[model samples]
Target: PKSTPAPDRHRPSSAPPAAPAAARVLWKRGDTGRDVRELQARLRQVEWLVDGPTGTYDDLTERAVSGFQGKRGLPRTGRTDTVTWQRLLGMSHEPGKWDLYLMGGQPAAAPDLRCTSGRVLCVSKSSRTLRWMIDGRTVSTMSVRFGSQYTPTREGVFQVYWKSRHHVSTLYDSAMPYAMFFSGGQAVHYSYDFAARGYAGASHGCVNVRDEAAIADLYAQVKTGD
Candidate 1:
């Protein structure tokens, strides 16, 4: 579970969907993932859309894509081709969890069975909430943001293997404070981006906690293992 550079999942470490490559990845209507979410975010930034960034490329997203393409003199395919993505990227910036979930819908997945007993960091995706539970009793709860659709936070039970009070990402040089590593590069950490943007941005693969004080408390309570 310990890591240096390989485990860090910062978006900059890998090419964004809009990055140039020989084989292009196109996002069309019905496609669902972080890429699509990003496309919608960009459309919203350029004022071509104000509907849903539901992480799904629905008809509204399609129309937005087409409209953007047409405005930029590209083909109105309603598909986010590489050229279109690149163009949009030039016009807009990346989005966060709150930005993607602009309407502020909570996640819907329940905690794993492992969380019911023993000390556990209960993360419920369905409600986008994390519960710090000790012996099946809830100690504290806070809103959380997992990774983006592209690099999703993992599921299943994992123990905290390491902890760092202050960690800076090797690849992206982003600061991750109070990081409690449960999986390789992925940890429950305090993200400045999450705090600043709210849900407007997302994590690479880490569980991002916005409340610094809350995460500091949780970090103190959570040891290397239960």
Candidate 2:
């Protein structure tokens, strides 16, 4: 007896759809961007990198990232991947401009005619650096901070009128160690605030040096009226 066979129903496929893949981040050496700068900055905070948050994934940055990965039990690939970045983000604080360039990496301007002549504590506002020049030769340099717009740092050559190794600002009541008085209360001195805050803060119309040891040495070398 031939009953019309019912058409076979099509079965639904049993295989499930593939899951969406996670995003990936991979920055190897030779990469250049703000992201690399951030990577370097974080590494600097952890003391894994030095020299720069120069915004380039240089060899140092590669080494630093690799070292950090190894320290955290990750593979030492020397390439900054998403996992490495995530771990670093967890470990480090976001960096400020000064944190990225703690030493004020601005290039030094050409020496002033005065600076090239003889011994001079040549200060450059544009570069934010102070160079101790001897007979036109730069012996040492350090990062410096100046007064703000309200109390602008004076421009023009000045001589060290007085030298006080342990001077305190009588007006402000702050310690002004290695204070080399030049004009009024505007002196080149070691500023704890400058050391800690970098260019974030300003002096009360004084030139502030961050490195205490360098200032001390400069204090010894500099004399009155010179």
Task: Kindly report which residue pairs in candidate 2 clash with one another.
Answer: none
Q: How accurate is candidate 2 locally (lDDT)?
A: 0.85
Task: Write the residue-wise lDDT of candidate 2 on 47-100 in tens digits.
Answer: 898665777898899889889989999888899888888898999898976666
lDDT for every model?
0.82, 0.85
User: Lowest summed-lDDT stretch of 10 residues in model 1?
Assistant: 102-111
Per-model TM-score on C-alpha atoms: 0.54, 0.64
Task: Give the runs in model 1 whose Cα sits over 4 Å from its true position.
Answer: 1-112
CA deviation > 4 Å runs, candidate 2? 1-35, 38-103
The TM-score of predicted model 2 comes to 0.64
Query: Which numbered prediction scores highest in TM-score against the true structure?
Result: 2
State in Å the error of residue 72, model 2: 20
Instruction: Please provide, for model 1 over 134-179, each residue's C-alpha lDDT reduced to its tens digit, 9 standing for 90 to 100.
Output: 8777898887888889999999889999999989988678999999
